[model samples]
Target: FTPLLLENTQAYEAGKTGTEIPNVVHGVGVFSVIGGSGSTLGLIIAVLIFGKVQAERTVIGISIAPGLFEINEPVIFGIPIVMNPVYMLPFIAGPTILAAVSYILMDTGIIERVCLSAPWVTPPILYQFLATGGGIKAAVFTAIEIVGLTILWLPFVMISNKQNVSEE
Candidate 1:
């Protein structure tokens, strides 16, 4: 994704001096898949910290380990985020916003372009640094994205918890 998106940008800047090298696409992987699509690490944390329903908490507890490794089958199938309308908005919006922010940061040279691909399961902050060739800015940016997405997930998780309580 990064290579492809940057092709034109890279070409345009090839042999050019004083032109901003377009590296926005490298950010897509870092931002979108930092903790898996939708930044499920944030979702998992939101669930564990605020989840009131025993069932949901149990599912999230089981999911956290895998979520850290960038595998979210447990939460997706267990919490069944798939086909669930309630989580639809956050699921879509969180990654989109994070990716957009990441692109802006990389495009503006606030953070370095991701020059290497880490293993998919490398984990968040560590993965960010590794992917960006050891840039502390990448790790910091990742932390910000994680926290922002977690805040985005917070209210939704709380509302779901309240609904579960009411249903019981």
Candidate 2:
């Protein structure tokens, strides 16, 4: 993920502008599997903090630790976001919106391009800082992404909780 985007940005930034690739790569990391591919960390937080469903809360509780390490398999499969239609919209939309926003910020020079390479499991805020070579702006942008994702996921979580309650 980082390599392709990083290479494109580096090439474009190095005065080799032939293709239409923009000098924006770090944004990929901003939205990548942080808290899981769909930004499930936000979803997890939503469940734990505001979700009324006991089962959902338990799933989130069990998944939170792995989520912190950027592992979302449990939440993804456990919360069943993988095929559940209820969570489909926010699951896709959250990361897409965050990526678009992050890209715009980076393109406009609000945040720096990611020049450093870090492992995918580096965690969220810390990953941004290390990937951008200690740029605080990257970390801040990551924080914004997290907040944005949280907001995006909140509605779906509430809806799911409501459905669960009515069914019970």
Candidate 3:
């Protein structure tokens, strides 16, 4: 997908300069981490502030560091979100909405498109900054996305709290 995205973007006239790379390539890193560490960070904060389930702490503890590095298997498997109805919506919607917003921002030229490639493992704000050739707007936009993703996950985390209480 990364290669295809890069090819597609480069095929376009606007993308030829690398400044106008599309969401597919530019968003690769964003999308990869947004759902993983990004959402996990939100879940951790939400649980700490609002959760009643003491057991969630274990999940948070295990997930926090990896989440920072854009790895979320612990959160996903720990939360058991695979078949959980409560988490499905925000889990999918957060990244989708973010990508859309990113696309819009790039389309309108409000922020520079990703003109550089960085390791997907790079932290979120830093990755955006490098991808945009050190553009501040991209970094700012990534920060906004992190906040927004956190907000998106908050209510769901709270809902899971309820489920946890009920189950215990």
Candidate 4:
């Protein structure tokens, strides 16, 4: 995924340089992680976008948490997050939006205690409900997260459309 993503990155950079590098390349191992880590990332994203949420307190940021253990990229790829339309939107949008909102809320004292630390990997709606002490159901969060991710997916897909394209 990083290579594929870089394919687009290099292309964009080359575009600026007025050179035709024809950057991207594709092959097997495409869907290899789809069933495993991709699903996991999808689940976590589903939870955040549609589920509970995060940010701030430098030592306690939700974004930086999974990253501490080098667990983030798996979710990024395992959820097959890079290209799958179903999992892509929330993977990008949910985190971007949540990071901003959480930062503002914490900085403004709107919500405190800094989220502490919740499990990094849980199904979308279930994680949300659990994160909130099981105070809610999955249906509502799932619907909203789907919309959020979809909105995110639109622009992302449009921009990086052919970068990592795999017909497999």
lDDT of 3: 0.68
Instruction: Report lDDT (Cα) of residue 38, candidate 3.
Output: 33
Put down candidate 1 lDDT per residue, 1-168, tens digits, no spaces: 756545534543363211144455755767686467767788888888888878888899888888988888888778878897777789888888888887877777787666565788888888878766677887898888778878898988987887787876
lDDT of 3 by residue, 1-168 (tens): 567456544555353533345454455445335636335656665666777876777787777777776778887888766788988887777766776777777767777666656776677788778766676887887787777777888898888887788887
User: lDDT value for candidate 2?
Assistant: 0.76
Alpha carbon lDDT at 74, candidate 1: 89
Question: What ranking of all candidate models by lDDT puts the best one first?
Answer: 2, 1, 3, 4
What is residue 38's positional error in candidate 1, in angstroms?
1.7
RMSD of each: 3.6, 4.0, 3.7, 19.0
- On lDDT, the stronger of 1 and 2 is 2
Write the number of the candidate with greater TM-score, choosing between 2 and 4: 2
Every candidate's lDDT: 0.75, 0.76, 0.68, 0.36
Candidate 1 pairs with clashing backbones: none
- CA shift at 123, candidate 2, in angstroms? 1.3
Candidate 2 segments exceeding 4 Å error: 1-22
